[model samples]
Target: MKDRIALIGLGQMGLPIATRLATAFDVVAFDISAERRELASRHAGIEATDDLIKLDSEAVIVVSLPNPAISRSVLQQLAPHLHEGATVIETSTVLPDDVREWQRMLEPSGVRVIDAAVLSGVAQMEQGKATLLVGGEDAVLADVQPVLEAIGGAGVERFGALGAGMAAKVVNNGVAHAVMVVLVEAFAMARAEGVALTDIAKMLDREDGGLQRPLNHRIMQRMAAGDFDGGMPLEAARKDSTLALAMAQRSGTPLFATQAAQTVYDIASGTGLGRKDYSAIAQLWEGWTDRGLAYGA
Candidate 1:
């Protein structure tokens, strides 16, 4: 029989991971909203319920929550119910130290904790293309590789020890956001200075004399196509940006452009563009400068 798994939090990230897990395991899921659970139950292997108490003592518990406090709350609440051999997989975007602390808390219950941070957003998770960064004992992760494979269709990379995966994810996302803020601001100025976005696109297309990365192609293509809705939403991006800034501050690293970029996202999120893609920062530029670079005006 396939091992039983209990998935908590059926929001954007949770729903996709739960649905995907249902394909390979018998999944029992919980969400604060009935609608989300109803939506998740459409999958073949899902059994949605409202009771956290129904989680089996031996069930592998996978949590995809919004923040550390919530993760700790759920862990504390579920500790007694979890079986001795069960594992709790945390996939939230949080500090690596948070995972270490969670592990320490759960240690007495004999329920193991693993830092399994998902490195992509809702759309990617739905398509089974999300990447998983795992940090735990080698033997524990090895035993759960199948579940990781089911959700992180691209692959899983085990960094090392208890907190490494979270650190890697935090840094990776911080760098990506920092770079995007630069792109948004620079392109806005380029359009303001009377350079056609088409001209800039042409320059970027050439491999020889441009800032080159696969992300450059994706963001440009998204701008050219005017399809920014399905990517990482602005609110989520803003949260990550703030977290990134905090992470930088803690490390005493004076990061450039990150705060300015985060401010842009803050404005966009406040103006009811939270559900839109992070690329929609270009819209904020259009509003401020009365110029067009992202949606081609």
Candidate 2:
């Protein structure tokens, strides 16, 4: 017989993941919504239930809850009944601290917890193209690798011991969400300036220009090496930012991310980093947090 796996949360992403896992393991699915439970029950390899107690016998449990609070609440309710040596794979997009707390809460009961952040959407899950950013003991992760592969056929990136996966997920999301806002702001300004959106898209799509170069080439290399010297200086970049702001003001365009970025440039320049590379703006973060973010620091 196939190994039994208990799956919690059958929402948008969770439901797809459950169905995918059912292709390999005998999946016991649970959800608070009756409709969702019914939907999961219709799948051939899944056994859907409302009772949390029904999951007690399963050695592997996967959680994909909406938020940390709900995840904690559900885990708290199920903790006492979990069999010894059970491993819980938490795929919720929560903070590293939150998963660490869960690990602490479940450790006394011989329940192992691993944070496996789902890095893709429902469509990716359904297509088996999703990736999992995992953090846990190597042995425990190896034990559950097949289940992870069943859900995330794209790949699994193991970040490190517990909480690292959530950290990676949060950082990845921060960049993606911030870039989205930046794009929106840029598009709004482009529309105001009568520039074709397609033109802007084409410019940004270039392999040697736009987002890729700055992130993958000069700036990132300089920042990573802590060698912020002899490049387009911060002062020059600040001047360019000033020009952009002036143009935006003249065009009656309000900028959010760009305006905020200008503030960082201004502050970094004022602090005598104007002579360094434009990437020196990163130093402000190190100073603010008293942490070395540069590689090998």
Candidate 3:
């Protein structure tokens, strides 16, 4: 059974995902940014549009927006027009409570809402190697397998019902951000202590699960070489980190590490490094300790 899919949001994360889906299915995709829409059309073969309602009629609708508010707006706009039995897959990071609310809003209209947050980064999408944490009804999930298969690259599986997928993504991003902060802090401290920054980075790269394996390592290498580009912008990272902290607080969960990670990103943002790759969090090192990473570029 061919599944017609519509994807909304064409930002950094969504564009690649939409592109992968378009490779296997006809995707009606839209982005709030006109430039992004045009970019997706050029690169992905998506039928890009500015109209949110136009996407509502597809067999399965996928969303990969920045945060909860934008995702909710898309859901609210599309909810009234979605056909019965249509599946709505949310790949955005959002609060679990909001996911339940969306489920409630769409269920009455006979629309099934599923949370399917993409795990890992955009580079994984090219290899179709990204993992999807899914939450929704079994039968509904079964119905959209082909659509999920085409886009998920690696695969998809249910964690449980309603907001479980989002919970997984929430925790995953929180921990990952924390780890990145730790990596930056340790490297910076080494530099301040008179060890060469590049040498320390080289040492870390040689350790098991080397930094170079992750995309950020490439960015870190660049940063160490004074390149400071490649990974997600520190501004975007700050937004995600902030969202994670907000979600944790709203749920009465303590995320001390997550909170600390937010502060580090905050420092990066404050230091005018928001547009730089998140690896620029190392600037905190250079700023506080006066040690600079020499970049060959």
Candidate 4:
């Protein structure tokens, strides 16, 4: 029989991961929201619930959540219910030390914990192109290859041991956040200096292999349409970047750029842009430049 799977959490990222697994595997999914569960059932073919016991029988259980606190809470609840030898995949981006600590907690129960952090955006998961870095026993990883293959259609790299996967994910995302913040700041500055925002972005696009064009264009469209309502909320980015700093600190290193980016993001989140996309950081720049970057109605 195919191993039973339990996917905990149905937030923006978790919902999609559960949905993708459910299409082929018999999945028992859980979320705090009946609305989210209903949405998942309708669109993803998974049986969603709020009960924790439903996970007891699942051999391969996955947890996708935000922050270490929530992950710890769920782990405490599941530790009792999880069967011996059941493989628990921790896909949340968290500190390596936390991952190691969870491993210690699960060890006594005979449950194998793997720090299986997902790479690429949530959108990439839909296309089965998400990369996975699995950090745990190679034998256990081989045992669960089917489930990992199902989720990571593109590739899965099994790092040597626990916490390695999360370390890679943190470094990768830290760089991405840094780049995103720099782009936002530069565009805001160009506009302030009376350089046509569009033209300056176009120049950057041409010189930078058009990497910023899509992002710049998206922001421009939103600005032009006066619909600067979302992209990646500054608050979430702030949290993730903070996560990066914490991870770096633990490693006895410093991320100078990430720190600077965090400051700008802090300003946005402080003023209620916490729910808005990270792109909205540009608004903070507008405030400093005393210019209206707001476009469109």
Candidate 5:
């Protein structure tokens, strides 16, 4: 069997994954950025291209795009060219409905669509510690499990039928944002009570599990320093939040916390901080209460 795969989108997340996958299989990297394409091409065993038409012969195509619309667009462009029995692994954090749409459009062409919602930062993906929440036909997944496993060090699991992966990813991102907001608010309360962030960190570390203190510690440390330079950008974070809210409305589920968080995110984006790390969300709490949530005074 030919061990070739095409990877679309060479942004922050896609670039590292494509480069890593190149170590185990022939990788064709695609991105709109000439610079990113050039960079990935330098990696051994990886070919970079700006055109999906160049990937027409590959049996497997993995898309790690930014949003639902782009994922659908790329798949649509590639659908006409994908070989029969080809599997398109969508690793974007998009809506489940979007995944279904891809399936409907491509399955008739003899192409199989699967959702592989990747979790963890780009740095983690480079280290092969990322997790993929996968949803698709069982036989299709089994055929592509090896390639998927190569990218997921945190492991991959079949969550449900098509769209389940996206559903899990949306809920996961929404809950994460909601929790971050509440944590930031609680830390603000700690500030009001005259507790230093340094002291709070020590207090938080006292717990072993279930608190997510280690993760919380890193985010709080960055916020204290007003550092939102690099990480999951506020823009990408907002897409997940808004999508979650949309899903809630469609399902008639009350998502009070998520809705509240979205308002805060809206204000953050309005302030021209959308390109900054989602940790910039601290700006909201900082405005409500005067205090640096960082380690020092």
Candidate 6:
């Protein structure tokens, strides 16, 4: 007989993840929505239910609720019914503390909790191309490796203990979402300056240009090495930003992200980092928090 997997939540991401898991295991899918339960029942190798009790016998349970509150509520209801030695893989985008709380709540009953944060969308999950940022005991992960591989293909990375997966997911989303807003702000400035959108896009897409230069080339390398000596100095970068702001003002373009970024360069310049590499702006955070970002710091 095939291994049984209980999946709670059949929303956009959850539905695709459930279908993917069904390819390798007999999935008992649950949802509060009658429509979703019906939809899941139609899929092969899936048994849909509205009851949490039906999930009790499954050795592996995956929770993919919308938010922390709903995830907490559903897990609370299901916790009492979970049999000993059952492992719960939580794929919700929640805080690291939330994952720790769930682990605390479930440990008394011998129920293991693993934060398996999905790093991609529904389309990726359906295609088994989603990356799973996982955190849990090594032995626990080893036991459920097959189920995770079934859903994420080969894109599973275990960060550390229980809450680390959620931490990685949070950091990844923070960078991605912030960059998206910065891109919009950049495009607005470019459009205002009469620059062709396609040309701006191509320029940013270049490996030796804007985007890759900071991430894959000079800036990250400089930051990682803590070697903010004599590259394009912070003073020069500040001057360039000043010129961009001036151009935006002339074209009546409101710059939010760029303007905010300029404040960082201004602060760094004022702190006598003007002669250091422009990436020294990153040092502001470390200085403020009394933390270190460099490899040996």
**Which candidate has the highest lDDT of all?**
2
lDDT of 5 by residue, 1-297 (tens): 259888999998998889768868999888999999998988898999988799989888889888888987888888888878998889988899999999999988899989999878888898889899999989989998888988887899779999999899898899788777655654554565567977776666565422554356436556767688887799998998888667556655555555777888899999998999888888777777987666575
Model with the higher TM-score, candidate 4 or 5: 5
Q: What are the TM-scores, per candidate, against the unseen true structure?
A: 0.69, 0.96, 0.64, 0.65, 0.69, 0.96
User: The CA-based lDDT of model 4 is what?
Assistant: 0.78
Per-prediction backbone clash count: 1, 0, 4, 7, 1, 0
Q: What tens digits encode model 3's per-residue C-alpha lDDT throughout 66-164?
A: 888888887888888988888888888887787888889898899888888888688997678988988878897888878778778787867898899
Evaluated against the true structure, the overall lDDT of model 1 is 0.81
**lDDT digits (tens) for residues 1-297 of candidate 4:** 245688888888888888778767878888888988888888645888999888888888888898889999888988988778888888888988889999898888898888888986899988778889879887888888888877877799876688999998988899688777766655654554566877866777682343654356546665555465666566777888787667656655535655776788787888888886667777777789988777622
lDDT values for all models: 0.81, 0.90, 0.78, 0.78, 0.82, 0.89
Candidate 6, residues 161-209: lDDT per residue as tens digits?
Answer: 9989999999999989888878887788899878999999999999977
lDDT of 5: 0.82
Worst 10 residues of 6 by lDDT: 215-224
Question: How big is the positional error of residue 95 in model 6, measured in Å on the Cα after superposition?
Answer: 0.7
- RMSD per candidate (Å) reads 15.3, 1.4, 15.8, 16.0, 15.5, 1.6
Q: Per-residue lDDT tens digits of candidate 2, residues 1-297?
A: 129899999998899989899989999988889999999999999989999888988999999999999999999999999988899999989999999999899999999989999999889899989999999999989888898888888999999999999999999999999999888878887898899999998888787756776787555688888888898888998999898788889988888889999999989988999999888888899999998767878
Order the candidates by lDDT, highest first.
2, 6, 5, 1, 4, 3
Tens digit per residue, CA lDDT, model 1, 116-232 = 899988899999899999899987787778888888998898989988999999989997876776666546645555778878777866764345633564357665566677777
Name the candidate, 1 or 4, with the larger TM-score value.
1
Candidate 5 residues lying further than 4 Å off, grouped into runs, are 198-297
Clashes of 3: 4
Error of 1 at 173 (Å): 1.8
